[model samples]
Target: MPTPLYQRLAAHYRDAVAAGSLTPGARFPSVRSLMAQHEVSLTTALQVCRVLEQEGLLEARPRSGYFVCHPAGRPALRLNEPEARPLDPAAYVGMHARVSEFIARGRQQPVKVNFSGARGAPELYPAEALRQAAGRALREDPELFVRAGPVAGEPVFREVLAKRALASGMVIAPEEIVVTQGCIEALNLALRAVTQPGDIVAVESPTFYGLMQVLESLSLRVLEIPTSPQTGISLEALELAVHHGSKIAALVVVPYLQNPLGSVMPAVNQARLVNFCAEQGIALIEDDTYSALLDEDVPQRALKALDRTGGVIHCASLHKVLAPGLRLGWMTAGRWQARVEMLKYAQSRHNDGLPQYAAAAVMGSSQYDRHLRRLRATLNLQRRQVSDALLRAFPVGTRFNTPPGGLSLWVELPDRRDARALFAAALAEGILIAPGVMFSNVERYATCLRLNCGNPFTPEVAAAVQRLGELCLTRCRPGAVGSGAAGSAA
Candidate 1:
């Protein structure tokens, strides 16, 4: 499922184009120059240029060389972030219904173009390489097929994971890491280890639906804290919530490229969060699912990396950046490592050993780094393309987040138009979209929607976006009150 090397080399120019460093009509580097600069072979150089041309980023003239060709004249969008809400503790309810209905509708009807979930294309995953790795492992240890693995994951896989965790700014012992089915299971184990059934768990307003689902499944009440569309959850609001006596047991947060909003918490905020959680005796369950998708300059700033008190339960998955089919995610439970491992054992024993072997082989080898690089590159291009499409299709005042990483766009419709209405209309037209209200347990952000940019921005998708805009213009106009969607969603 992984992309070719030419795609990796093409990602360099793709980054430049995404950053606007290489504007429309800007000439591309010559093939010979690219070969010399990247230290690639002539064939790779040609393939890179070929991909660029095929993707419409470049056009070749009769005598002249390749030059940039992309969407032009799209106006720069201003940030119209959601209003901040004070600490309001509420229980999770019917969230799965909303999300399930959206999913079920897509399945029942034929979805022509999907913008619902933030999932990557198969080309972004390293499947063939993983197959080869699995083959090598099988040949090396044919008995592994019959042998049962450790209850806390194979030591070799844990060692590889611990070393890779260093890149996220945390030095971990392999013993502290328990490989789970995926990040979801890791999150489940963390929550189960920390709190009882009725205990309250704090989360950001308009948080990831999956997290809400987890809280619901565990019978945990939710205390909603106001979060910024730019920086992430506000520490001041959370402190006031806790100090005001919410009796919050744990805080489950995504600090990097958070889903729906696509916000990356700043380093200072990360430090403050860790310190606050530790001082407050609150278990900090940090989801590093999107940590690998953070911007290059801010890559090392994970909440766990700032944890000096070992209070942060760091959870991460290789499912997104590595082989997508291989369900491998690990978590270091810090002080609760024993409890987490016990919960994991009681729940599902351990992940399959064949996958562990394959994952370890891939992680230890050089292909892991290559997969991450090309994955980021491909995601960057997809984001840019989708952003351009949105700008061209949606009306003025339709605000969206342009994160340096991740495959999400939290779009606020013009004049507070109804996002659910748009969702229904888009579904009728065979296009799927995630309504913003689904992110919140209560009715909020009805004017907002999340668009996944993982797929290629095809002409058909561009047309679907245009149609969706037309629906937003006509179906959900701005003029109502009491319904949080029309009034202040603060």
Candidate 2:
């Protein structure tokens, strides 16, 4: 499809804003002026501004017209990121119990507002469409309900997955893809295929807690690599770690829309990391759970796309943007394909046939593409609203990453505001949030926390956020800190 005229114009303006040519708080041209300058219809001009407005680049005023959304200098709503700290020494896992305790407490003390889990808004899910797809699959092969699926995957689902992999610039046959219970299982099998107990593995600092939990279960030691909030894992730091003799067996990373942090790795960075891993003989296990949430214009961020040595183990599932309940995930294990497949079977055996066919039915249709577009737009809007609300609701000196597109924002409390205290206070009031300490084993992120933008910004949610902010002011105690910025520097 040709690029929409409004989108092209919007991209142009977005670049100008990012380049500082159009500074923050600058006035946007009027609709008539834009039409005259671009020689387009009034509707096209209006659309360009509308897209910018939705993206938080431009703000519309009733009579003052549109200006830049974020003001030049206040700490609120800025994109300041936390300072990258030094890499800590490799160590065995110890956070699983703390996370479990936090979760258990929440189960006992249920909250009114939940910002803990990264799930999409209820309206974004295509319930009726999924139902129809399930019905079609059932009618086409009623025996699917009774028979076991192939150990790799149902052929229909694998075919669709192989075709869909092209979006990440990956070219793989259906046989190379190993279907699993979910993304979690794919990650587990990939790690198991490559490493043994007591082996050392590399993971991004403040990575998805699930990866940490998995490492803990496997009894593997971890080497935490510094990660950037804007671009993702630091290649220089990874090289430094490896150069200094950190015998890493494998590295688990999320190159696009990294969990908790919401960083999108640049294309060059992805290629370089792939080459580094391939040359060093390190298994690059990629968690691609959130890459589908990005726009089509983004560079092919998947490490598997540039994997020539067959070192990248690509893992992903539809839970983030598609049917969460489907429990379908697939992976390509590169040179370890056979071993990973065997591990998959030995671990869980073949998956059930019914859901695979149903997922394939929905994913094979044009409705899937339409659903992706809608889903991306919804996530972008939610991220923006939640970021804005955080700035408005949180205390001063606060910092946050205004991720380009994702379901959560990494928030740093201002004036030594404590996240654990916030978690405790919020829990008492029935509000839930993911504290930053759970994300890392070190003390660096003790004051930081991640807020899920997956839920809609309803009146109740907004009030809960406001209350949470009030709690931060009342319950949080001050302490010495190393450093912090106004917002993400992405």
Candidate 3:
């Protein structure tokens, strides 16, 4: 598979912008000039220019040609080394009040700029297509709305999901799949099936707050293992904890494009983790929510694919990549399938049939594959644009690693700067951001923050980045207090 000509041309300019060669506000060549210089067709030249513009590296004036819009800024931040010590022993997960308040404010107040939520823009979804699919499903089976379906979900939907999972290297029967309201439900069920209250669960430090909330709700204690921004949770730390008699009941991890940090576990590590979990008799709860959004040429296999001992429980959803409003998610619990199914049935009888039918129709269509390709490209482009913006906006000494694929960028600010204060300040300006405290049970990442990169880099978004940069600079100055009191008034 050779690289497309337009992509090659786009890469040429992208490299220039990344380097200092083409400085900010530098005008790009005209379409005709580009064609002549590169010996390509008019269509290829136009596509190349469009790709750059979409990437936020170039802007087009009414009369002027496309010009580099990204300013020369500090170098990319260095990766944060994984912490070596064990996490602070905590019985409960805190920060519920703060997170609740943030959510309430987002709903009540009219935000000028939103950088908080991880959901993609509504326009990015295939809404009309899904609507059509729903209508077709309803017309095909008018009785679907009137009848109750199985607790394991609609049989047809599960069949489609089973077929689709094959692409990710998961081999499972339709009977083994259980549909839930969302991935959260699947995770909750998985956790409930394996362990009791007071049991210890191992999680990546600075993991998703929702997982912490789940642990808290279940009265489960957590052993936060050291995790890397590029490689995910450390196997050595995990083995040490197990060897030191941590008595870990289960391990919850996002194997591909992990949230917050965006780390993807290497294949070798995935194999090791599966084998280790099996040998230790610990159940592994794998969150595969973002797996479908991977932008890489060769998609990685799910952790469930290597489960020979039936220890890997896979949880996934389509909300991140497809129709979020559908609220459809599924899971395949290897050895714990029966327990998970029973728990799901007791909690919620079954998912709604209409949405499941609609999802099945969409997933079984060729259009779904096309939509994923476009979605992946758009997300990758947005990730780069946001990374460039962050590099230009934040002060020196900031640290972060560009994730291979995902919707977020985890940023570590200067030691003196408190991200909680930055969050409050940014909120006061009507720009929402997820402070680092929200992601961890402990206060390990107080100076860090996670930025959402699911949306496109429009002019409004660009201005918001600039404003956030200005706010950060102000806080970095001496005598600055980060109480975030200003946000309370708003």
Q: Which candidate ranks first by TM-score, i.e. highest? A: 2
Candidate 3 stretches with Cα past 4 Å from truth are 1-71, 476-490
Scored by lDDT, model 3 comes in at 0.81
lDDT of 3 by residue, 376-423 (tens): 878878877887787777777767656767787788776447777777
Q: Write the per-residue lDDT of candidate 2 for residues 1-490, one digit (tens) a residue.
A: 9999999999999999888677554578899999999999999999999998888788775555887665333434443443555567889989899999888888999679889888787778887887887888888888876787789988888999998888778999999999888899999999999999999999887788888999999999998777777778888889998998899999999988898788888888988888899899999999999887875544354789888888999999888888778788999999999999889889999988877777887788888888888888777767766765666777777777766666888877776556888899899999998988788776667677888888778999888888977888888876633334112222
Instruction: Choose 2 or 3, whichever is better by TM-score.
Output: 2
Tell me the tens digit of each residue's lDDT in model 1 across 1-490: 8988789879988899889998654468888899889888999999998898887787774455776764544443434444654444657555888887877888999888989978787877888888998898899999987888898999999999988888777888998899998899999999999999889899887888888888888898998777676688878889888888888899988888887778878888988888899999999999888877754733466788888887899999887777668878999998898888888888999788889988898889887777777878778877877777776777776777767688788887767678888888889889999988788886667777899888877888789888887888777766422354433332
TM of each candidate vs. truth: 0.84, 0.85, 0.83
Residue pairs in candidate 1 whose N, alpha carbon or C atoms collide under 3 angstroms = none
lDDT values, one for every candidate: 0.80, 0.82, 0.81
Candidate 1: which stretches are off by over 4 Å? 1-74, 82-85, 480-483, 486-490
User: For model 2, what is the error of residue 349's alpha carbon versus the real structure, in angstroms, after optimal superposition?
Assistant: 1.0
RMSD (Å) of each candidate, 1 decimal: 10.0, 7.5, 9.0
Q: Candidate 3, TM-score vs. the true structure?
A: 0.83
RMSD of candidate 1 to true structure, Å: 10.0
